[model samples]
Target: MSESTKRWGLLRHHDFRQLIVAESISHLGSQITILALPLVAVAVLHAPPFQVALLMTFQYLAFLVVGLPAGALVDRMRRRRVLVAADLGRAVLLGSIPLAWALDWLSMPQLYVVVLLSGVLTVFFDVAYQSYLPHLVREEDLVEGNAKLEAVQNVAMIGGPAVGGLLVRLVGAPIAVLLDALSFLGSALFVGRIRSVEQAAPRPERTRIGQEIMQGLRFVLANPVLRAIALSTAWLNFFSAILESMILLLLARTLGLSAGVIGLLLSLIGLGALAGALSARRVTDRFGQRRMIWVSIVVTAPFGLLLPFAREGWLLWAAMIGWAVTYFGGTVYNIAQVSLRQALTPPNLLGRMNATMRFMVWGTLPLGSLVGGVLGQYLGVRPAMLVGAIGYLFGFVPVVLSPLRRTAPAPVGEVADDLPGSEQPVRK
Candidate 1:
């Protein structure tokens, strides 16, 4: 393969192709749910703002509840089995929604139960998914692999919402969820087809699960770069949750926008994210990965301030522009940081490291959702979203001030033991 072909050569691997196909189907399904689930709560159930927001809280609360132990467990099992089981579980859980609705038995409580249980399954899938990649592809291909997957996610983001809007408009939100459930089944089938063999997890050798979890925690905390990335990402997710939890309510109720229009507006974030994912490799090549991490956020996050000013007219377009820009930057930052994380950790620690990071970064989402719900309940949705947009402006501070700014990208297939304050050495 020529250098250019090799740079994008992951597609040549049959297993990698299967992985992306699985992810593509799953991402599209997920994007549909992202719009449909909340709409189900708002439109069908006539849920109040706080209750609508609580849906998000229930969805992400699993990360905090099972995040650490999930990592240890993933490391001890076949990641592919974990992925398939999670996918099947989510399918069954989501499939119940349409069934309940059909039987005229759907309730807010059922929605909450479905979301919460589905989230637990998602937690396991996500940790195993990240940990499974290195086993599937070479170290040098990490960035490319992550970028392609991220791109697939963004593409789904662009199309799924538009499709979801049409589906919701035609069939109502409850039936729309059925597609997502089916997609999970499709994802499971594709994943099952991947032929690469995952070695059996080594025996635990008497190490307790708690100690394993703490070991992952210590590795992340002790490393300056990982620590800063985790902090900044957590901060970003906190505010993002607040913004996202309220956006649908604001557009649907406050601005009086239709579902179709809202879906189009939401797709703008995907447009921006797609652009970022496409450009990440070249951009990182020109600007060092370390510099790009902070630079991306610093340049694009400020646009989020425009979101608070959105109204029914031209101002809404301006707000969407801000939203798109913010997602663009966020996608770039994500690719860079995730690749770095994958490269830095030893293979055995991948599950725990990813879990610990998820625990730190995603744990705040529930809190943010709760806060957004409260703020929207008391202060109104627009004002609550304004607070979130403002918070985005400062999310870059941790990465900006960290040793990561002064560090270079770690060479492929090797750890940077010389990194300042590096405590846990990567096990070869």
Candidate 2:
């Protein structure tokens, strides 16, 4: 199929439009709820700073612990159904927060459980959704489709936080969470209406659960490109996590920015990401997705470095704008990388492959935060930001050192050394 033909087919498809709309609503809800949940932990529950950090720790633990398993389940089940069920589950779990608050039962412990449940459901939705993508659009438009989804999400990320900040300020944090829960319900309704039949992957012969887990691990390990991307992203997430815990504190005490101000700036980062996503495919088509991936990774590499330079007034404004550009570029890199991966990976192993990759990608976040917390305590937030930035920038090292920089697309399962000798081999 010609590139022009692929592009036209994707643009003409009605199903993609419906999927994008439902996904946009869901992403917007996610953006708002993520912001609201932390506020509930801090302002309403009166959580100590450290304990507030723990909330994210518990929430992301599923990404580390159960990501692979969840991927396996997604592969074995109906992908679209899993996505709808996950959204509905999140709706119910998040709705409980406000109900508990109303009944005077919304303890900090209860918040923890809700956070855990939300994280678990998110893992399922994300892995399943990624696996489901090939079925929704034609082969050629995968990058465009993913790019559009990222664009919507980037817009939502900006809008959601900005709205959340206002909503939290107007109506307490618990109620802010209810808004998110409602959004999930909205997503569920639209997603349920979509009528695509996601054909299932043929399940391999039964083996011990451990073997299946190892199989996923080995596949990624054997694939250099996948491994490099997984580690690069995971480490970036880890280094960024360092600043994540300390940023609110730094802005609150050191930089003296108000919550609303900080939230708005954060929205700028998301807006920038949306811009990146909107342009990513065009950039990739013109420059090659592989090259764009490296450029975006390298350009946005200093997300942590911008923190120390932030100051009151114009200085902070400059810093936020810089950070926003980097954030946007990073989104483009992800769009390119994930789309490239999707295009290259075989349909049968897509679920386990996505799960394996994400387990590595998201697992590094909390560990990075823990290290950041200790460094922030000892070295101060500014110095820690500098340290993390230097580390974060190294995400480029893998691409810089590897063949990925010059690689061109091949048919699925034949992309250089980016995959296992054969899919589903057992790893140590």
Candidate 3:
């Protein structure tokens, strides 16, 4: 290898360094919003359980609304531009929240609108950002690149919540959102500075939007590995959303925990994620890629049963442990599956493949939140959480039954050609 090439590990890779900076900034901002947004709903707006669920629903609803079309559109444009635009758009939307609060013009309906708009922009940014990574690094370095990004991202995750909680305690929830808005602007600046020249790959014939969307879906369904990932993750996310939707309120209302303590508990998940990010490559290397995907969830998800057992006294330890364990497993599983997906997909199809899988996995989150809110209202929070744990326990079935259980990792270029219907997309 050339000396220059050897030195350009993701740290030295200019374009990738910028991408990492952008993502790291964005992740921190997102973590802050995660805590602050819910606080706003619960404390300021006095939204009910179902209404809180509606807020969460608005935050992710874009995936269901425009996911497929966004994927098709991303494939036809320069990815970096899409990312920049999304970041700037989110900045404006989130910035509006603080402005509205200062003017005493903030309302629940306005918050919902802002959240929904932010989600739509996020959908666009994520589709473009995930698709653009491979172009920044060598094919073999994809895993390392992803891990590096996640590592710092976990750091931001760890700190952002703690800071956000303190800010909410001191200043207020609406004011805390301004930090997120500023961070988005920073992310946009970093992303816009990347010098990589992104151009749409030339095609012999352009297909209709519906066909392009279908092509992406077919590719995922036809590939056993991708199909397994989509199904297992979809189920896991569904149940996870159920449990997570109530955690903040559970801590605050039922347990009467302060925002600082609640944030500390949430940061434990970030701590676990950081550990998982650091060890993902090593763990996957030792266990083999596909095996770890299902194994991680099977082993970790059972801890979720402990969550509902948590109560005010020492029992709160049970919830914290469960949160940490489940998060660790999730982080490891994500690193393995995401790297595998990026490696296995053809570069031309990366955007669509990621979008399709996201639609499958994340589309269920809002539904899960809604169901969780209903269960929390009707059955009580702990019982609802218990039910979610049961779902997680069985969520591994789809992947366990598929061929991925026995598969091993392989290079990206070698993997895609053998998948069924891969050749047909180019022809159409």
Candidate 4:
């Protein structure tokens, strides 16, 4: 397919549209839960700051535990089936939360279980979803598809939090979570409606799971571009977790902001991300993808430094401005890097590549949340945020030192000396 033929009209693609719709609804629901779940922990269960952070930890813990195996498993199944199962599973688990609350039996441990189960399902859904995309559109269309999907997601995120806040104030956090459950159902329906035939990979002969998993690990670590992306992304996520673990608590506890105000603030952060998503294609086209990778972080990450200085009154607006800027930079970086990863990786290894990246990148989040929560308890909120801000400044170092800085499209398939061979051996 040529560039001109691939230009625009993605929504005209039936399966791609279904995917976009499904993912858009799911993103909205996830954002609502992101706000509502923490509120439930803090308000109803009366969880301490550490426990609240632990809730965040549970949400990413599955990435560390099941991430590698899940990749190998996803490689063996229909990707859409995995997505549907994940959505339905999350619906059932999240729906249980509202029921427990109604029965007046909701406990901190149960909430922990809900988040952990949801997290596990989410890992599968995410890995499968990314792998499935190439099957839906041309390689040239990946950037546009991702950009449009990300833009819609950001729009949903913008409204979802405000709606969640209103729902929390009116019906309560438990019921707000119920809305998310229904959204997952809606997503499942849309996904299942797709008419596109997904051709499953031929079943490989028996092989050791560890060896298969190592193939993925070797591919990632061997490729210089992927290695740098993994390192830089992991570093960024660690600091991002540290910064985010305290945002709501700081706004509510220290600044004495209400739920509605906090939700609005969160929505404002999405506005920045939306802007970045809207501009992603244009920016990358103008600056070149390679330069945009590091440039995005360097230009906007510094805004995070303004957060620790935020105070009540007019200064609250300043805090939000800082958050918006950081959000913008992060979104642009995500869109560009994700598209690059997809383009570089071969189809057979897509599931493992995505999972391995998530394992390395998202795996750091749990520890970072714990550390931030503990540090906030000891060092105070502003100081903890200051430390996170300083960490963000260094996230660009790995990319700056790598081939991604100089090349238009970084070279793929180059295995390092200390690792397995570059070619992934067929299991059979």
Candidate 5:
């Protein structure tokens, strides 16, 4: 390997590369599924706009309500097992859709139920997966490791929307979801094959279960950095949710855009995300992670508002492009934040910490989804979207208002071991 190439984490370790490949393929499936699911509700099921948004809201609910408990479970159990179970469970749940559809037994309500259930499992899989990264690679490698994953996801996000549109045009929406299910199984199989050494753990679960759960919440809430991020994420998600389903609806109904144009625009934005993820490490070092996170949130957030201004042809595409830039910014911001959080957290509490933050930030999603529909119903599409854009501006308020804005990266093994309820950072 070339010296410069070796300096970055491209081909150094087999485990990291395996993770990237597995996650990349899985993300493509995930993105495709997410994109296709909404299209299914709209085109095939003939559901109203509100019902379609409900599908997305149901999926996000797991992160908000169940994230903490799932995290606690992950801390006590094997992370790899959690990932495997989550993957297999999601595969079965998702696969049921096509099966039921083929049997002529599929219904809108059933699709909603499937989405919700699969989302619940994903909450466990995601929290455990993030925590497990520290065990897979060194602290210095965290940003690089996460960057690769983020880059792929960004690529998928771009492609997923476009791919969904085409698949709907070609094979029908129900079948598109199958692609995602298989990807999960693919991820499960690859993860099962990794034979690398895991960090060792001591005896599990001496502390009371309730206490353990609370400890994770306490650490995330009390930590300034995590708290700031949680606040930022919650606001961002809530506002984004507000406009979530409304975008495609507006494009189709109000602006008179073709489905192909919408898909293409979505895919084009991914190019920005790929760029952001590729350069995240250098950017993080230059600006410092904390400031960058807030700056990115604040600056990029207004993209949602631009959507309302979309008129025709160039104008509509312009708005989507604006959103893509911000989406890319948000992607890099998250990579920075995850790396920082993992670096600071003790191994034992990593899962819990991840879950606690996820729950709080993600929990508000349903309300946001509901509000969007109601606003669109009473006020109109553009106004409702404007409100969503305004709300997203709140993401940076907590960060700008806090002392965490200037903090440097915390060293590894500083997992607050001195605290009474602290457990050592759990290893595989």
Candidate 6:
């Protein structure tokens, strides 16, 4: 078989195909919510810049609250069950928004509560989803699997926003959210039909949840490469959150762009990300994974500075181009780093390791959103975005300075035993 065929072979597996379908549907819905949820607050409710930012804060706060514990819980449960349940729960939560709106009872508090609860479910779903993939594909195929998944997500983003924007304009934002709710039901159906059985890891005779959580934490922190990747990713997420919390506000309020136009502009990020996902394997093959990780960020992130200058006419076009390039770099960086993390981890610790890593990386999102809200409310939207755009340039520093620069990518089916501070043997 050709190398290309080998890479694409995972699509032939029945269970993996189901996962792809589920992810495709789920991601398309999520892309709609990504645009519509904030628009609900900003357009429908007349939320101030600070309050609109709080929507993001509420959505991500669950990662910090339950991220580590969810990892331990997932390690003890069936990951597939966790995934299906999370999807169903999200469906119910999101479906409530339109119901409340139809009753003339929709309020900011209800919106906050819905996003917060759904985010909790998301934390579990994401942890299980990442941990579950290894069971369905070969070790060598991890990068291809992750890249395909990322590509599906970006593809959804490319179309979802435009559709969502039109829906928001015509049917209203609350009604647009109902479509997301229905999509989750379809995702749950696909996930439930997956036939592959997960082989449970052996449990210790006497184990504490805290100890398991700590083990995952130690594994990440002790490894120089994991440590640096976590730090760099966290930094990137922090500033990116700030930028996202305000970008809609800038477009809708400052530029006075229509919902349809805002959606089209945002689609550029998805477009660039799709290009990056399609290119990641080739880029890694040519440059090597280590170089690809840092270089992707360093080269493309600087373009984010152009975002602050976005105005009517040519500047808007320049800003959108820069936005797309930045997402392109981020997509490439994520695929390379995530594949490395999955390759380096042992099977027994996969859930916990992913949880710990997410806790560290995604935990910054809420804090950044809160800060952005304050900055936008007090310092002004454009200036706040400038702060975030500037911070993007420095996100690569941790990875560039770490030992990851010197090490080769981990080989398939084997941990990088030669690396300093590799994971310790799991305690029984």
Task: List per-prediction Cα lDDT, in the order shown.
Answer: 0.90, 0.76, 0.84, 0.85, 0.78, 0.89
TM for every model, in the order presented, reads 0.95, 0.90, 0.94, 0.94, 0.93, 0.95
lDDT for predicted candidate 4 compared with the true structure: 0.85
Give one digit per residue, the lDDT tens place, for model 6 in 254-356. Answer: 9999989988998888999999999998999899888889999999999999998899999998998898999999999999999899878876677888999
- Of models 3 and 6, which has the larger lDDT? 6
Candidate 2 matches the true fold with a TM-score of 0.90
> Arrange candidates by lDDT, highest first: which order?
1, 6, 4, 3, 5, 2
On TM-score, who's better, 2 or 4?
4
As for candidate 6, its clashing pairs are none
Candidate 5 local lDDT, 299-333, one digit each (tens): 77777678777888788778888887778777888
Q: lDDT by residue for model 3 over 1-428, one digit each (tens)?
A: 78887555668878888999999998898898899988888888888877777788788888999888888899889998999899999999999998998888888899889999999999999899888887777767888888888888888878988988898899998988988999999999999999978655655578888888887887788788888889999999989888888888788878888888887778877888888888888898998878888888988888888888889777787778777788888888898899889888887788889899989998998899889999998989888888888898888789889887766544444555653334423211
- What lDDT tens digits, residue by residue, belong to model 1 across residues 1-428? 69977765788889999999999999999999999999999999999999999999999999999999999899888999999999999999999999999999999999999999999999999999999998998877888889999999999999999999999999999999999999999999999999988865444364788988887888788788889999999999999899888999989999988889998998988999999999998898899778888899999998988887799888998899789999999999999999899988877778888999999999999999999999999999889999998897888899888888776644423442332222332331
Single out the weakest 10-residue window by summed lDDT for candidate 6. Answer: 419-428
Show the lowest summed lDDT stretch of 10 residues, model 1: 419-428
Compared to the true structure, candidate 5 yields what TM-score?
0.93
The lowest-lDDT stretch of 10 consecutive residues in candidate 4 is: 419-428
As a whole number from 0 to 100, the lDDT of residue 276 in candidate 6 is: 94
Q: What is the lDDT of residue 385 in candidate 3?
A: 83
Give a tens-digit lDDT track for model 4, residues 215-251.
7888788788889999999999999888888887888
Report the backbone clash tally of model 3: 0
